[model samples]
Target chain A: MNRRCSLITILATAAALFTGCEREEIRVYSVAKETAEAPAKAASDTPTPAANAPRPQLAYTLPAGWQDAGPTPMSLANFRITTDAGEASVNITPLASMAGKEALVVNMWREQVGQKPLAEGELAGALAPIEIGGEKGQLFEIAGSRDGQTVRIITAFLHRGGASWFYKLQGADAVLTAQKPVFVEFLKTVRIKEPGSAPAAEVVKVADPAPAATAEFKWKVPEGWQTLPAGQMQVAKFAVPARDGAKAEVFVSVFPSDTGGALANVNRWRRQLGLEAVDEAGLKALVTPLEGAPGAMLVDLKSDAKAMLGAIVPREGRWWFYKLMGDTAAVTAERAAFIRFVQTAP
Target chain B: MKLLWKFFTSLRLTVWTLGFAIALVFLGTLAQVHEGLWDGQTRWFRSYFVLRKAGDVWWVPPVFPGGYFIGAVLLLNLLAAHLKRFQLTWRKAGINLTHFGILLMLVGGLATDMYSRESVMNLREGGTRFFSEATREHELVFIRTLDDAREEVVAIPTALLRTGAEVRDAKLPFPVKVKSYWVNSTPDFRAPMGKNAAPLSDKGIAKDWDFSERPETKGMDDRNLPTAILDLGEHGVWVVPSWASDELLIESVKRTYTKSVGAETAAGMAAKMAAPQEVEAGGRKWRMTLRPTRHYNSFSLTLLKTTHEIYLGTSTSTNPQGIPKNFQSRVRINNPTKGETREVDIYMNNPLRYEGLTFFQATMGRDEIVDVGRSGLQVVRNPSWLVPYLSCLLVGIGLTVQFLYHLIGFITKRRATVAV
Candidate 1:
């Protein structure tokens, strides 16, 4: 190839890269956030109470033959009732807000039972007003077939304290129909108490799922520590080089909250080491606050042959656990370094 | 110049480049087991050099020539050899055409890799959407609500959202200080605050939930939920996680609106306004969210219906769930600018191509809790989609012509020998 031709080929290749590559750029645009006009108008017309109104304590009386199944992760209150027809379940869940998309929620239940989503125009007629906690609430009843069986779902929701509470009763069609009257009566019995007031039945507080946020944790690793693949529930793992024919492993793990608290975790580690579990007073004497790391507690537990040096630190609504476990000699050798590692971590 | 020309046209160089390509493919395929398909393809095939990450550190160094390097060398070698043996005669036509075809394919592949983008659009029955979301990319967007139901949005791509970086733009009122960014995360609802549990944020669901980073999942069905913390200075630090719904934050912000209402009528009006979370900055109400990167189009698609078929007699005593046979989504396309309106069905093996975009029915399911049929459409845009077909056609034609030329010459030689 001539020199000119070769130059052209090189230029063409470079040009291809520039032409094909999609540049990542900041975009500014004006877009219509909402597409449906009907739903937005309907939401505006819906009666919403004052947002700053004092939130009332909610308590409910259970219907006869209904067993309290206790609160679940998703539901604040759960109850079960069984009959010859089929078992029915009742649960109360709270959503911060639905943003006036109650029709969407109702349509979700409809689709669950193999029914189509309800149109916005038909949403008002589909919902029946009922009393809940002495306030007006809307009730939706949907019936459909699922897996060749007729199923029914009855959901009643009320807005309070800038949130929506949904009380849903779902079961087979025949069972739900039989319990419809009883369900209404149960709804009528729901009463609001003054702030911090206790009633005959206490509403169970359910834990909301907290998404784990990543925060940078910085610590200097001691020399001779070989990095190992972290196992499930662990953030980091390292193997200390063998010394005196004994080896120790370092594990760093974190949890959303204090995993069973410091005493329980310490006792569990003690049990693993075949040592007697200690009480709160014993735990207080055993664990010392890690130096330079505020709110971090360090504990040293040693058995006849096995030993564990652990630290528990709480930060940002999460608990960080660092442990050095293995042979007694190895754990003792690594204890100082392990304490330093935990102290330097954020 | 002569030495370089000889080197470029060397058969030895061509053989080595081809050998490296084979090795690149083999190694890249194997690397997918550890790095995943997307990451492996990017590192081994798209890049010019194969880079190896240092143990437990961010340092990565090039270890060997990657696919792009080998491809470029092979392209140059072919061009040199073709030019060196160039002839206008019909006998050389087949060889020249084959070389040109390969060159076209190489260029096309590079073009496709750079320009083509894949995204997904999820629509419920009777739902309409004008934008598709990228599967892997994410963006932090600040939106200001305007009159007439419109919103002015300023989006920052994930590449610019590094931890500790203060991102500033002309459109932004305040510099956004990124505290942390998690590539993949999980929510722990059982956040029991310890005695020294310092609050991460005063706004949003982060006040109640704790988030932690997890290893990125490679499964096709799984997606990484990224979380970020932004220090908005006087506006307060906010923890943002990629939640399916933004109602929690919207409600939290609205709760503050209730306190501002002085009159009874104003309180009633404020109560009815279920507005999004808005921060007052630069005399504008800004709402921020970390969400999937979106590619908006002028046209819109509304899902009319979704049909999920199951194999007959698949549900038995042993198998409670029936086997899925096929899924189809009926969608209506509406483009006001072009004045185009049409309805089409997208199903397995049958994709709908409209206006340079192809939509394939990827998955179909119903949300049990929400009672809505969902259809996931895989949207792909490739300008060079036809290049591979044309390249293969040219090669096939060239090979056939070359075979015919030799076959005719052999037949003629046999005839002349018989005549002698």
Candidate 2:
């Protein structure tokens, strides 16, 4: 009886030890279903009246020969300025109630230029006081080399209207140096339009610009091709007829030559046609000279069902593209004609 | 039999095992710089024998005894010593209790190592979450949305994503075949006309970018993002790692669909808008995307606000360096099944222990552009989490009582000797 009782006790203890802790059951719910069923309750209850308030207007004048790229997600305003050397970009961003400080911002920009962050005492020497929008602002110019290429940056910071507005222009050293005066002039025109205030008549209206003159490039159209008016960022557009009744498109556009370099652009075009990208040697072998335009390169690639013909023309620090893409058969037949059109483009 | 009993209750064995444990901890701490925290723990603490790579070679040879081995030996020694040498008396009760507590701790540690789960829940300001994602594991989730406002989910853990393996479930309409899997990969863009290019597997964004195998990350802050290329027989899909932001997934879907549908015309491609991908599977329309593996909970938490404050002078020129002083999250927990709702403030060192889980403030940051705060809460569920606390208390009481008893006995003996 004693042995049996001891055995029973051991077994009971083992059972209790193993069964002491229980695993909790996991419950799964459809968040999407719940949200769709009760949108009002499912949404956050935090009141954000300030989020719905009307934003203050920011006004600025465009420098001569500068084109506006409109607003981007991170920038309040973006402009592309073309110079003889290259194209430079000017971006204005307003950070409202940001936790960031001036020293941090300056140091971040310094790091971008491959320079060490300045000490507190060195900041005063690095920054120059400038007048912007009738307010005192700080301007900084930094020049450095990135990947064997000389790059320059001009940055300005203005504290006004409960926000820190940053204006930065970056490009090749030569082009940035040339556009420094224009950037300074542009900064002087910055103004903050108060809420519910109308702009004075003398102020340049933010409305769309008047229709511009026709683009300078001209080319002969092939037979059965329809010429369409060019849209934003395009010099010309043509609809070419494909044998399969599907319409192919041809576009003529120009951008800064430093935009991702020639190899990257070629690879981008190749990716669109479902072709594999090539190395620099392969790209050089594939590129043929344009007959009419000297120093211009043409690339013709054909895939299973699609084909792309493009010409990269270098002129005055700008790279012009004359591209035609369509069904394989159509593009093959029109290859010579597209090349001729690109050769004739001036 | 006498010799074997003596060996089992030997204090020498305890000392040796403890020495091995100390060596294991020191080596494990050094290994963390190269192997990362999770790998180090698995290699040293969780295994029976700690192994070290034979000089840069792939072979791992046993170098030292591991935590489990030492712990098991120590537990046996304690039990044997107590059963054979300890006397059952009021004076010895404290010693017995202390030994018992240590034994409980050893067993509890083993159980916790096997059963504990850790995950992280990220919440933006005003965001709600009912699930937390696993930190070190990946899962392929197949969700079927029913018409009755319900969902049936099938999650396949990363262990099953082997090449040529077919995973099937009773509720799944078809089996999924794993074509390829990579624990760590670097994204490589293919050259359009380059020779010896990798073949495109699926008709998705992966065709444009190839993932090449890479060495695993080795740090506490970095993690390996496993990528898998799965074949659904007629259809194929590439599963890539998801970032904290869902916008990347949406943008990838948009770009992939635009290219696939022959919408690569400059105009059409430029006008593409972000959208989620939905596919009809198992007679139900399901939204499909590769996301972090989630552990669903019975309760839901909504973050009302998150605040991160830096030291007052850190923003000035005097300091010029931002040092975070405090990070906090105001959250409301709702358990619909239990009909319990409560608001809790979780901050550093002050975690909320509810429903057998502990939520601790792990990370906090602010989105500069959007001016919104984000918070990361680490959720830990360990059944034996209280074992160490109980052990410490028991040991403290036991030592105090034993010390007092010894003192009293010494004084009484001295007085008796003087009187004699």
Candidate 3:
């Protein structure tokens, strides 16, 4: 139930990212022979609607001599499409990337046209609205006569999730227009396996939180000092010890669950010692084993947030950590109590 | 007489002058939309010489504009008589700061106008500059190239050059015959020709001249003087000469490679070729350059990078268009004898100041390609910058005292009113 709840929350956030903000990207799935050559065929029994049979989920005609580009795990699909029409390239982005407004789609067009993203009225001439694949999307086109050369570019949006697939066609006016009928035909070809019946994503099991360690230490508090709960980014705050102001805090939060993982966490801390940015693996390289937890690793660092020390322990299926560290001076004075806090916390 | 003096020393002059100054600036700014920024000065700038010397009344104000000589005198006069107004308290000191800042700014303008020297120093990368020549907004130079001499520089007045195709200027090394003149310009290879060509009837500034192009070189060959590009027709036919000037001096060097008598090897160096450009008008030539106003310098700059960042997908401050988020350049500095060179890593907000030349990362542009790879640097050298600072300080002090005096007076008056 907990796992399901987590998945649902992630899904909700991803959905809101699209439906809530100024996002205009449309995810376009293409079976063109040009790229991402999946088993899907354009010549399949998928029939063209009679005038208007309420439109297909997604459909588009693959121009001649185009093959799938390659596997793109991050994209809406594993591959892409290409055409002879002035090297028109098409990629279907996933809905997770776009925040879900049509302007973002036009903004993407602005990027290509060498212009700043236009506000609604700014690109009224360029971005025309249209519906494709049963979902509303935007249409964008640009043209100019420069140095005696006339050219035109066109792009259509196919939005879903927090992402948009932009079907861009650019070239000489004649060249781009020649490919238009075929491009729209390709738009008609978009389809996914039944809605809500999507395949379950691969999952890795996670273990429960571990028992705390008993450290030997204590701290002196002022006669009456009130402590408050942190509202956001709690882990980033670490209390400072008394001296000048003598007021401080130390907090922690872990993600991807491996006690937030040991070796990587430890090395990340060491990076604060006049080191350079590193990858997770490099972080793992700087680990020292913990006496109580054999497979555990530990490290320390000082970043923009200040002094930090953390440890990583392997949990059920991932890594977890009981990391504790904060401001240099403040953490130094309260290190014993912090160790005590971590030892007794959930 | 004392009452008249009081009236003359009142805030009326200050207010009027401030309003006129703002209006002039506003008009100048609005005119820039079409006249172009470089051309903006023409619409509002009625140079004293143009009005006073030329006796042009429309541009001249019969009244007064409170510039340094006018505004300062009135202000100082008022300051002398208005001494009792300020009670001289610390509380009023803060208000005085604001006025002092303004005064300092005014004084600074006067100092700058009298002593500052603004000039153009075009240097290619890897070059250095020593002395820079100050320029006027619009002046003409007759590019005089003698049959035997290297090159002779002659200044021409633009007004005369603008009249007819055949302007007969006496200063030309070879009787300066206006072959063509253009106020604004674009390329027109369409000139009819044997050796010279005919000028086209273009309506705009770029259209006003006979257009022709030579190979785009980085040296004198490309530096053009402000011209009234004329059509000096032959006989009854006005012949617009289709030619280009390098604005350079080409002197021959004695060379061992000379194969014949009188055959010369010109010491064709860019620096040697560099000559002052002139404007020809009303049978006279005038050498000209623009003023180095505020931060604008005649030198060219290029931005190395402009990137925008976002935080947690909430707000993005990207340089969506290419206006530039920062200024960076590999500037080509040049001095008359010191030569040309560059200083890299001059970034935005951080300006490079050397000699009397200061280059600020003002904006960006490209030489030819639209929407890419160009930079603008505002170079300034005003002698009176310090004056404004001092003026501001004094005004601040005065305002501070005056404010406290008024506060006390207000309290006393309130008490009296209540008592009554």
lDDT winner? 1
Report the Cα interface RMSD of each model, rounded to 1 decimal. 12.2, 13.0, 37.6
Docking class of 2: incorrect
Q: Which stretches of candidate 3 lie over 4 Å from their true place?
A: A1-346, B1-7, B11-104, B110-139, B142-152, B157-181, B185-187, B191-326, B331-344, B362-376, B400-420
Q: List runs of model 1 lying over 4 Å from the truth.
A: A11-20, A35-54, A57-346, B55-62, B189-196, B244-276
Summed over model 1, clashes come to 13
Best by DockQ: 1
Better of 1 and 3 by TM-score: 1
lDDT of 1 at A293: 71
Docking model 1 quality class: incorrect
**Comparing candidate 1 with candidate 2, which one achieves the higher DockQ?**
1
lDDT per residue as tens, model 1, A241-268: 7779888899887766675689989998
Q: For each candidate, report its DockQ versus the true two-chain complex.
A: 0.14, 0.03, 0.00
> Which is the better candidate, 2 or 3, if ranked by TM-score?
2
> Whole-model Cα lDDT per candidate?
0.73, 0.67, 0.42
* Model 2 interface RMSD, one decimal: 13.0
lDDT of 2 by residue, B1-420 (tens): 456556766899888888878877887777766677877788777777776665423433457777776777776667666666667876897787778778888778877876788999977777778888888777766677766666766667767777788877666666678877777665533311111144445444454445566777766778676666777765556444332113333334434533322222211221221123345665666554455678888898988888778888678677654788889999999999899999999999999998999999998886322346778999999988988899888888878778788889999999999999
lDDT ranking from best to worst?
1, 2, 3
lDDT of 3 by residue, A124-196 (tens): 6766776665566677776543334454556677555533455555555554654566556555555533234
Candidate 3 at B156: error in angstroms?
A: 3.6
What is the CA-based DockQ of model 3? 0.00
Q: Per-residue lDDT tens digits of candidate 1, residues B136-183?
A: 889989999888778989998877878998888898888889999888
Evaluation by lDDT, superior candidate among 1 and 2: 1
